[model samples]
Target chain A: MTPAEDYELPAGPGRNDNWQGVTPRQAFMRGMAVALTVPGIILFASAAGYGALARDAGFSLGNSVFMMGVFFALPAQVVLLDQIARGGSLMAGTLAVTLTGMRLLPMSVLLMPLLKGKRATRWRYLVAGHFIAVTAWMEGWRRLPLVPSELRMDHFIGIGTGLVLATLAGTWAGFELAGSVPHVVEAVLLLLTPIYFLLSLIASASGEADRLAIVLGGFLGPPLYVAFPGFDLLLAGIIGGSIARFVVRSRGTG
Target chain B: MTSSLHEVTQAAGAASGTLPTGLTLALILTVISLATHEPWRWLGLILGRNIDVDSELFRWVRAVSTALVAALVTRLVVFPAGALGGVPLLVRVLAMLCGLGVYLLFGRRISFGVVTAAVVLVAGQSIMGP
Candidate 1:
């Protein structure tokens, strides 16, 4: 066998490289099915939290539930609500929320390589980009390396559609069940959203560098908070990631 | 006319009472705008990626993207709002750190890290008597 064949360039299933006997469409559908199934429980937790937040903020159940569907960015939505609750200006709230979402740009950039096909038209990405989030992004990063370039977007679409629907349904359930929940339970429930996100991060990370980045980021985070307060998280992540990346790259080069 | 901070907050509070259908509609429009821009963005990247992985422009893109995600995550952890805001900063940090430790010690499994962090937080709270 040739070196490339022996080494296995890491293409998707049924793409002749992996030899799992699946078509790209089948692989994509399978990936989507898996994605849809995995996030249901996690999404339920997030929905419950969102429902509680909406109730606490005095938002109508419909509006709160709809926001989850439309915005689909939890941090931004939380920022918008908190700023509003604190009596911040509407313009200010909007600005903060938008700024918080600035990550989407880079996330899209990093994710593009995995989701883009060699000959796929631009329209595929346009739709795929909407489904980009922490969960979807992590999954794409993990699975993309093995996927055929042409089938990545389809796989992503399948996964993204599942997540979108799950979030919608979860939010609806949360909205309906909001007031019925107790305060302590709601507090614990709210913690689940971030916890789910953190879990996703741990799942998709592959290298020692990523592991170090997460650990250093977590450790340095609190002290940074004490020192910089509002800016701790930004500083910790930037510093931790930079340090980890630099160290890893240096080791690789050396 | 320029309004005072209090006036602005009051106006915002009043606005909050009503559903932000207009804002939501505007957000939808913004999504459309972003969608329209995707083609050009993709084209630029495609051409760029073809050049070389070591190209300066490629590195710049990677750096910018990583930085942006880090910034967002940082913002959330440091300046959380709503219920997360209710949690003490030290506790949050400790929980996160403990989680990270678990992740590192456990072969980088995310579930381990998350569960460790959550368990620590709950345990700490219990020990401290709520």
Candidate 2:
């Protein structure tokens, strides 16, 4: 997507809000800058867990890194590993991965408004939409509101692009070290991912609906897995979210 | 679940170790996964065109995504496989709770929660001595 023009912010102090002089190039760099911080380190660590798992699952180091690089979404990649482990057919694996990938749609939908300025094209959004990594999307939601419109797309691309290194590098490192490390150490690393995901969800959750969804989904997920197996994640999410929404709406109406 | 599928996997497994890098299953997997994942982004371009960002429908969809992630994260904690499966179930559950407890107690300081959880998780395994 081509940058048409810049939207300058009124002078401010809390953030570097002077957008008048910042080019899309500069904003893109800023996005990269933000992603390479503590959050980036956390992402790298989480991805390292993925690396260890992938190697243990019998994926080649090259393949694991390649998956991390291309998929960029951690959970979907894990689903692929799950499929392989089950000796699932390719069609089954594709369906499961696609269901997981559906989460990206809402993520992109929420981001669209933030990425818009005067006369922005669908191409820009299409580009911005691809960088829909969970952390990237969450970080974008948290950070992009402050950004002037034209630069949001570039900045998001930068954030997503920069995080790619940490993920790929982490995956590579994990795969290479999988067997060399003590079993205990590898186990601990693998354990970090679920804990990290849980904590991040708790930390980032906002308002009643998110809280409700988290609670309901937590209750629903394991039981659904027993009954539905591969359909657990999708069913849990949809059912939990719908119930939460319905309850919230009913409360509002009453 | 079927014999043909089993045969396919057996064949693929047999070939995986020795296959040339150019034609490895990994390369094919990357292509297939990428192909499946790509259409959703484009689908976003289409759906995002008319959607109002703050509408209830939008929020509900967002809720669905968050719930899905929650389900996924918890499933890993609950029904773990692979390396994590080695850790006892009690250890995993406690690790999650301890992390969550500290995270909530510390005004949502993520690093504090993670570090606390990591300590519990690793320690739980050592204490279990398996």
Model 2 lDDT tens row, A1-254: 11111111121365556677788888888788765666677788889888987776666788788888778888778877755754545565676577667657666766666877753566766556667766777767767777887787787778877788778888887777767887667767787777777776665555678778888988898898778766777788889989888888888831
TM-score of the A chain in candidate 2: the value is 0.77
lDDT of 1 by residue, B74-105 (tens): 44455553444555666666776787677667
Calculate DockQ per candidate and list them: 0.16, 0.38
* Model 1 agreement with the true structure over A4-27: per-residue lDDT tens digits: 111112334554336255566765
| Model 1 Cα shift for residue B110 (angstroms) | 2.6
CA lDDT of every candidate: 0.55, 0.71
Cα error, residue A108 of model 1, in Å, equals: 3.5
Q: What local lDDT does model 1 show for residue B81? A: 35
Q: Considering only chain A, what is the TM-score of each predicted structure?
A: 0.67, 0.77
Best by DockQ: 2
Q: Candidate 2's residue-wise lDDT over B60-115, tens digit each?
A: 87577667778877777777655567778898889889988987776665666777
Least well predicted 10-residue stretch by lDDT in candidate 1 chain A: A1-10
Best by TM-score: 2
